[model samples]
Target: MVSGGINEILRAVEFILSKLLSELQSEDENDVEPKTKVRLIVPNGSCGGIICKGCATIRSFIEKSQAGIKISPQDNNYYGLNDRLVTLTGTLDDNKCFNT
Candidate 1:
């Protein structure tokens, strides 16, 4: 009975280690890419309400968005609205804006 219990514990430890190794491998693979670029056309105006305020300028909005930050512009404010009319072409990485 003691030996059997020890075997079971060892199996559990091995299973946990295998899972951790798999996750580590996946994380390494994901890290290989390092970053990706995506362009979005934001509306020229305040997002109002929540999630997107004070993001009046394209640069500011992009900076805030990349930082995983949120701002609240006034209701019906025209901050990010202009970008909608004119398309913005740029590159972004996992960190922030990247030069194309």
Candidate 2:
């Protein structure tokens, strides 16, 4: 269960980073890193909660709340086809994720 949660978080982060990279590509043609605000949200009523290493907070939330991890393909119309554009739609504890 813990491993599964870790994997889910990793996958979500990866997807987010990919989108960020694509967006940054259209900026000025310089080797400068753009500053951006990034947030990770997991359903379990942990919004605004402090984040730490080892993911003890999220792991504990999942274990105690019995929340299930859900992932789906979200279309952003970038590919002009819903099926071709894939993004992560994750929910935990009956709430829409990425709220934070």
**Candidate 1 C-alpha lDDT tens digits along 28-100:** 7756433322233334353332233453454464565453333323334654444332222232223232221
Q: Model-by-model lDDT, in order?
A: 0.40, 0.42
Estimate the TM-score of every prediction: 0.26, 0.32
Tell me the deviation in Å of residue 7 in model 2: 0.5
Q: Using TM-score as the measure, which candidate wins?
A: 2
- Per-candidate Cα RMSD to the true structure, in Å, reads 17.3, 14.3
Displacement of residue 44 (Cα, Å) in model 2 is: 9.6
TM-score of 2: 0.32
Give the per-residue lDDT of model 2 (tens digit) for 1-100: 1235877966766566667656765564464544444333333223323223565664555555444432233446465433321123222222223323
Error of 2 at 30 (Å): 2.9
- After superposition, the stretches of candidate 2 with alpha carbons farther than 4 Å from their true spots are 1-4, 41-100
